[model samples]
Target: MKLETLDALLAARAAKRAVALVTALDGHSEWVVEPGAPPSGLPADLLEAVRQALASDRSGVVEHDGRDWFVQAHNPPLRMLIVGAVHITQALAPMAAMAGYEVTVIDPRRGFAAAERFPGVRVDGDWPDEALERLVPDARTAVVTLTHDPKLDDPALHVALRSEAFYIGCLGSRRTHAARLDRLRNAGFDDADCARLHGPAGLDLGARSPAEIAVSVLAETVRALRRPEG
Candidate 1:
């Protein structure tokens, strides 16, 4: 990689954006492609390869035009935004961070959102709606709302539903989820928007404890992220 391209890749990593360094194995030619944009000064055929590499989050060599081309993906770190500083969050935040998610816990309740409780994690003691607006859920983000309170979780749901966030979950029972769906409908969300919510969040592993429930939720998230979309 050229110094200029290395700088660009480093800058993308700093900004938490996806980029890739592609090398033509035979000729030692190179290119950098970031998410949503193709690199300039590269042949058009390699653009498809770069796109594929970034999507799979993999670094590999592919055969192109009778030559081997290597595409090494440099993606932004994965993030999990949990909108509730409750017991479940206490369990989930650490679990998420352990699994490579840059976790952020948000709750307006200062006591619940206290840093001392979370220790070294990002705690945003802001209202859910406003906090999500600033946080800006993106494709690499997974959002989970554990508050169950309509005032808190609903606003965050609104933001997550509209974003490119890969996962959007809310903690509640079937009945509660039905009520929540009605509220979202009344709030102007279409069927498509409502379809995104993984209400009763997590795989049904009969999780009773907070830690177990967090495990199920994280498992579901990982499943959704890694598996092919239906």
Candidate 2:
């Protein structure tokens, strides 16, 4: 790789942006594409290949016009921000980390957000809204609210609804979710925005225990990330 290209890749990584590096296997040409920016002068098929590589988070060689090209995907770690450091979060945080997410648990209640309770995970003591503002959930992020408290969960949802985060789930019963939707609608969120929330979160796996619920939530998150239309 050329020094300039290497520098550009490094900079993208530093900024937590998704970028791909494409190089001709015959050592003839190279291109760097960041999906957020319009890729100028790239053919439609080549751009589509880059999009596929970035979407699958996989790098491989592809053939076009009888010429081979290697596409390398450089994507930042997927992030999961859990609001409310309650029992569900206790199980959810570690499971999310094991699944390759950079997980962080947020709660203003310092006692619940203690680092010891979540050994290898990050615990934020700031209020839900404040913490989320600083973290800034992006397109590669998944945000879940495990705290049943409306005071905490509602504010976080307000911000999550406005973000590009791929998944947003909330822990509550169907009736509770209905009330929450009313609150969001009254607070100015449209039906389309409110629809993004996966309320009573997690797939219906007959989950009762914290760990089981965590598994369900994680599965739902994965589904949202991979099969968004469904």
Candidate 3:
């Protein structure tokens, strides 16, 4: 690896950009495949392999055209952006952090987003929508709204739906979710877009306590992330 390429890789990681470093196993020649800019010199079959490697978020050697190739996916850090600093968030954030995510709790309330409530988690004091816009959810990010308040959840949902966040879950009942879907439809979102919301949020775990609900949501999020039903 040249110093220049190493610098570029470091910069990409810092900017949270998705990139792949490909090395020819035979000659040790290397190339960088950015999200939108794949190497034109690569064969069509080789490029497709690269795409699969990136999607799988795995790094390994691939035998293509009788030549071994090492493809390493350099993805951004996994993140969980929890909306509304509620009791569920208090439980979920810590769990997400333990699961190797960089968790951020977003809410406008000063007391709720206080340091004591979220000891190690990053707490965003900005309004949900504004904060989400700046955060710019990507494929490596997951957004969840725990606040039942439409004022907070709706705005954040609007912003998240417009982004490429991998997962979007909302904590609510089925009836509440139906009403929320109606509101989103009225806001000009189509059925396909509204369908993206995992309303009634978690899995069918029959959770009762806040901690239990958080566990369920986390499980659902992991499912969508690892084994996306899409």
Score each candidate by Cα lDDT: 0.90, 0.91, 0.89
Error (Å) of candidate 1 at residue 43 is 2.1
Model 3 C-alpha lDDT per residue in residues 19-69, reported as the tens digit of each score: 888888888578877857877887776677668888899888888789888
User: Residue 32: error of model 2 in Å?
Assistant: 5.1
| lDDT, ranked from best to worst | 2, 1, 3
lDDT of 1 by residue, 38-156 (tens): 75666666777778788898899987779898989888989999999999999999999999999999999868898888987999998988988998988889999999899999989
**Candidate 3 at residue 189, lDDT?**
94
- Give the lDDT of residue 8 in candidate 2: 92
User: What is the lDDT, from 0 to 100, of the residue 82 in candidate 2?
Assistant: 97
For TM-score, the strongest prediction is 1
Error of 2 at 102 (Å): 0.8
Q: 110-193 in candidate 2: lDDT tens per residue?
A: 688888989999989898999999999998999999889999999999989989999999999999999999999999999999
